[model samples]
Every structure is written in C-alpha cells, then in structure tokens.
Target: MNYFSHNPLNRFSEIRPDTAKMGELWRHEQARVLVVSNNLSLLQAEAREAAFLQQQEAVALANQAEVRVYLGSEGEVPYFALGFAGLPPALLPEAYELHDLRQVALQLPQEQSALLAYARGMVHWNLRHLYCPDCGSLTYSTAAGHVRQCSSEACNKHHFPRTDTAIIVLISEGDACLLGRQKVWQPGMYAVIAGFLEPGETLEQAVAREAEEETGVSLQSIAYHSSQPWPFPSSIMVGFQAVAVNRELQVNYDEMEDARWFTREQIVAGLQNGTLRMPPQFSISFRLIRDWFNQTGAYKLEELVSA
Candidate 1:
C-alpha cells in the first residue's frame, strides 16, 4: 500500500533527453502547462486542482518565461512547466490564486501535487543557473530543459537538474525515541535528526554522523525505511531508523534548541493533551514516527486516529 509518498509524475527521461523530440511535444495541441511565477504555482481558487492552461494561454506567457521544461506526458496529452521569475502578484488573475508549493501540495490532488513540486524545483534551478560554474560564461537551456549548455567557445560544459540527498533518521533506545526541536519551530514540536549527506559518505554513515553531531548519541542497527521527494527548492529525504547505543541527552544548542528521548506513553500523552505535535501526515517524518509507534506497540492505529 502507498503510504503518503507524494511523487506521481511519470517523467519520460528518454523523450526529454532529445531537444528535437521535446519541440514536437510542445507544439502538440493537447499539451497541458503548469505556470509558476514569483515562487508560487497557479491553481483554480475554487476547485483547487492544477489549472492547466492550453497552448494559446501558455504560449502567451511562454513568450516572457525565463525557462520552460518538458515534464513528460500523461497518456496522449503532453505536459510542460513555464517559469516566470519576479512576476508581480498583482498581475495574477482574480479567478486564480498564486499559492506556494507547500500549500498547493496539501490542497491539490496527488498527481497535481507531484507536478507542482517538479515545476517548482526546475524553475528554481533555472533561475539560479543563468551562468556556467565551470567557466565564467552565459549558459542556455538545452535537451528540452533537462540540461544547460555553456555558451563560451573555449569552455563548454553541460549542467543538469540537482537534487541534494539528505538523511532523516529516528534514533530509538528500547521503548523511547529521540527527537529534536529547532528554536524557530513551535513549542513542543519535535522531529527526527536530519542533515545533508556530504561527499563520499554512504546513507548509513550520514545517519550515524548526524545523530551524534546533533544529539551526541551513537547509533547502531541502522535500517532504511523509505524516502520522500521534499521539493522546497529541491531535496530527497532518505528515511531510516536506528537503535541508539546510549540514551544521553547532550544536545548541540547550535544545531537544535532542545533534544530528549520520549517514551511511547509520553508521546501519546503529548499528542492527546495537545502538548506536542508530530509532523503532518503529508510528510515522511510523520510516517517514520507512526511506524515506530506501531512496530513497538506503543500506540494502536485506532488510538493515533482518535488522538
């Protein structure tokens, strides 16, 4: 069974790799476009589904777009994303609302939510990569927006979309699991320890390092659980669960405001009494916590629903 992992778009990598092939998809009459402007995605205010625009409306905006990516097809209909950086909010139509991807994910259907995340990530990449990093030269998008080619005659290179890998692990010792809260987060809200994976490090190594650095606890028995596409800009969250060697609370104040182990009973009481809140059901964090509770028989599925 699917457990709230939001990715749904069937990205046709083979077709998108050919620039000539993507040109035909763009001209197809049945093409559907997702318009993103000023870090917000466009959607119908009433129905809240992705308000796909036809070629006519899309072409009009495409004329002024910073970049456009071919996001593959759903059956016979083609899909594309048009990005407009710095577009004014006042220019948006009254019938359509410019909502952030986070809000759109919660409001839109599974497919639409996945599509919006793709659009947001591609647009952000395009905006930040107008110049080549290899050589100080201008770059142009190629391969149907899948790659960027350097314009410099002396130094030519290709750049592709980037997704940073991060590890989010729940550390457990016996019946209790460790959770940390950042100072900026709401009071009593805690989640798993997470950090970006450094070069030459495996997922398990990253998990161990992050756990010790943030919570000062060594972890063993590292096991992979699942992963989620977190498209705030672009990130892939690799989820894992591990057993802590010790249950000491030595939090790095610079990394997190507070850290502590919460027993299953305490966690349940926190939720029941409104003293703590887990990550929303839409995120992998929630699943990691819930999975632990279920596996340990800390709380029944029905108890979580009522709490």
Candidate 2:
C-alpha cells in the first residue's frame, strides 16, 4: 500500500541508452517534465498534478536546472526530469504550488507519487555526481542524461545513477512486535528496525544484524514482504517480516532512544488513543505495520483516526 511501490508507466529502460530517440522525444510537444528544486517540486492542485510540468513550463525553468534527465516514457509521450539544487523563486510560476517531496509523497496520487520518486532520485543523483569518481575530472551528461561521462581525455569513465539498499523489518515474537524510536523522531513516533546494507552482507544478514544492533534481538526465518522506492535521496527500502528468536531486549542508545515490544492489543489501543504515532500511510513502515496487524483483523489507524 506504500505510495512509491507501484508505478503505472513503463520505464522503457531499453530506450534510455538511445540518445537520438531520447532527444527527439524531449523535443516533442506532449513531452512531460518533472521539476525538482531544493528537494521540492512544482505541484498544481487544480490539475491534481505532481511536479509534472509541460515542455513549455520546463523550458521556462531551463536556466535554473543544472541537468535534465530523460525519465523514460508513457506510451508515446516522453517524460523528463530537471534537477535544480538551487531554484530561484521567480522561475516558479504562480499558477503552480511548491511543496516538499515528503508532503507531496503523502498528498499526491499514488501514480504521481511513484513518478515523483523516480524523478527525484535521478535528479538527486545528477546533482551530487558532477565529477568523475575515478579521474577527478568534470563529468558531462550523456545517454539522455541517464549516464554521465568524464570529460578528461586520459580517463573517460561512464557513470550511472545508484540506489542504496536498506532493509526494514518488523520483528515479531508470537503476539508482540518490536519497535524502535530514534531521538530525532517525534515524541511518540515509532518504526520497525531499518539500516543500510553493509558490503558482503545478504538481506537476511542485514535484518538479523539491524535487529540485534538496535534492539538486541536475534531474528529467525526472515522473509521478504515488499519493496518501495524511498527517494529521500535515492534509497530502495526492502521490507521484510522476521520472527524474533529471543524475547530479551537490549536497547542501543546510539541507534535508538527507546525500544520495546508491543502486543497486538497494545498497538490497537495505541491506534485508538493518541499514545502512539505511526509513520505516514504512504510509507513502507506503515505498510509493514498494517500488514502485520491485518492478520488479527485489527482496525487500522485510518479507521480509528478518521472515526
């Protein structure tokens, strides 16, 4: 049920390498562009559109963009992404509203949210990698801006966008599931254990390690749940359901401020009352929790809160 999980449009990854065809599509009148500036996007409420600007609107902000990436196509219409690390206020049309990507992710339609996640990830990658990692030379955008190349004659290396893989798991032991809250999070907010994958470690290893490190709980029978594109700067959140091998709890202060196990009844009560705060409905964390709760026919937060 996460916002960025299912995308309707075809990525057309096969055609991204074709520079000539991409160029032609970019010049097409019906081509759509998503403009991302300073982690915000151009949103038009009237049209229920998410940052997806027309070609003319995109061209108007050409001076503000550092790079434009071809973000594949939907049928015959092409989609492009414009990256703006520093966007000028004047360039933003009064007709459109500027909203943070996080807010957009929750408020926008699922299809639009998915598209924005993809575009924002590509934009962030283009903005951060302006130089070659190998040669220390200025890089130029190529392959419809999907690939960047080193300008140096001695060492011309091609670079592509990268996604960091992170594992988030709901660790359960019989009737209760473990949840942790970071110090920086809201007062009552809690989420499942999550951490980036270390080199030479499998997803199962990551789930076991993160669980133990954060809550001092060992996990058994790790199973994949679902994955979501969390473009909070290009991250693929891999969700999993893992059963805790032990009942003992050891909270790691460095990783989490608080860690505890909540029973299904407690979670339901928390949702009914205001004692707990869940992640946004559009997040994989929410989906993981909801999916786990659904087995017991427990009422969801939306039902409790909306009532």
Candidate 3:
C-alpha cells in the first residue's frame, strides 16, 4: 500500500488494491523475513546461535539458504520466501520466530524504501497468522498474499489481512483546529484528534464520536478526505475535516494530557520551528496537518489513511 502511494498504485495492474488483491501479489514471491523472537532470547548474543541450531524443524532449508533480507545488505538478505503450498509444514516446532510486519518496519533504517517496507511487512503477517481461529487448523496463504484459508476440509474459513481502521480529524472553528498530545509524545508534540473505528460505525461517525468523547466538542459537519497506510503494526488512517461549531477544551487524562484549539498562527509556528515536534514526515498526520495549514491553512486531503 505504501509502495502504491508514490507510483501509479492504481495503474499497476500487478498491484493489488485491497487485502485480497494485495495478498495475491505477495504469495507469488513471498519471502520470510525474520524478527528476533522471544524464544531465541535475542537479548543475549550466545542464545541466537543455539536457537537457530535448535530450530531444525523450522529451518529445514532455511539455513545455508541465501538470506534474502539481511539485517545489513544492499538487497534483501538471507530469508526463506515460502509458497502457499508448504509453508507451515516447513516451519514449526523449531522456535524460529516471526514478527508482525509493522514491528519489523519500525526497526528498519529510515532509508529503506517504502516498497521493501510493504513487502517485508505483508509477508511477516502471513507468516505469523498461519492458522484459522474458527477451525483451529493451519491456514495456507491464498488469494496470492492477500488471504489465508483454513486447511480443514470442513470448516473452510477464510482470513484476510487486517489493518486497523481509524479516523484522524482536523476539527476546526474559524481559523483554528483542535489538537492534542499524548503524554508519551515527544515534548511539545501535538497532532490532530483521532481514534479507532469501532464496529457498526462509519468514518464520519467515528470522527464525531471521537471529537465528542476526547474533547467534549460536537462536530457540525464531517468531510472525508484521504488515507494513509500506517504500518505502525498495520493501521489504515482515514482523514476527515470536521467543523466544530464551538470552542471548548476538555481533558481526559487517561488518554491525553490535554485537548484544545490551535489558531492558524500557532500551527504555522509549530510547523516551521520544530519547537513543537510534529509526527514524522512519513506519517499522514504530518502531511494532513501541513496541508490543512497550506490550504488557507492544516493538513492535505490525501494525508488521510485511505487516500
């Protein structure tokens, strides 16, 4: 998804749009990327070798194999790219670990292109989620890399790749937008109001509810903008513009230290000076906030998760 963000994501007939199409493309060249696992006691240096040696069952043909995705390499390092046909059977019992794609992406060098990030992340998801919850049997990669189907002849359940759907909104009244900061945020860093989408809720509903719940401000109108695939463990952030008919700051210490309105002048200073830390440039939120400000002033439309 990040790969398509730059290129003709739609133009590439080879690229899959949603989870289904995407997985189809991934399985065709699915490679195993390793994340140091708890079993290995990766915190210790000596433990890794023994863990690797012990994981005979999982590494049948993996070792001595060209590490396709090297921790440090020009191309991908030594990693097993498995096919839907014999993956789980090839990898079990050994304790060799697998990590979610998002976690892996976090550790990668900033220079690593988004394409590698996407490929590695997607494959990792397939590797970790190899079984169906319904039948409790192993599920094989399917629909290319987009899905996993239970091997049980009877249950036949299908599991698709999942991305957390959240709505991040620019709640504005006049020349100001609502912003807040998590206690964990970089000092002085503040960004748009956001929250996950609960079941039975639409993006607009989520936005309105989050604004009300987080800041006790009721939104009058909601406008859908764009989206971004946040592989911070796989979330797709949908962006929105909500007009706040009133100005009110509410604090919910459990989630945020504070919530309040930021006039256009305040945001402009924050962006240019970095005196106020913004979300990484790679994040849609940064772009969203940036674009919004640029357009008469806030984040861009495409800065949303979907766009």
Candidates in order have lDDT scores of 0.81, 0.83, 0.56
TM-score of 2: 0.95
- The candidates, ranked best first by lDDT, are 2, 1, 3
Q: Would you list the rank order by TM-score, best first?
A: 2, 1, 3
Estimate, for each residue in 223-287, the C-alpha lDDT of model 2 and write its tens digit: 99999898898899999999988789989998889999988788878867788888777888888
User: Which residue pairs come into collision in candidate 1?
Assistant: none
Candidate 2 residue 216 C-alpha distance from true site, Å = 0.8
Best by TM-score: 2
lDDT of 3 by residue, 1-307 (tens): 2221441112232332244544333232322333223111111131222122212233454443221122121232222232221234344334444433333433433333243334444555675677788979988765444667899999989887687899998888988877888988878888888999999998888998898888889888999878876645467789888898799767677878877788767765655665665665566676667667767734432332223
Candidate 1 per-residue lDDT over residues 1-307, each given as its tens digit: 1122555556788777776778888989999888888678888885478878887677767877888988878888888988888765544545776787674465668767777878888888888899999997999988778888899988889999899999998889998989889998878888888999999999999999999899899976899989988768778899999999989777899999988999889888888888887765667777788788888664663366455
**TM-score, every prediction:** 0.92, 0.95, 0.63
Lowest summed lDDT across 10 adjacent residues in model 2 is found at 297-306
All candidates: CA RMSD in angstroms?
A: 2.3, 1.7, 9.5
Span of 10 residues, lowest total lDDT, candidate 3: 38-47
Q: Per-residue lDDT for 235 in model 2?
A: 91
Q: For candidate 2, give the lDDT of residue 261.
A: 93
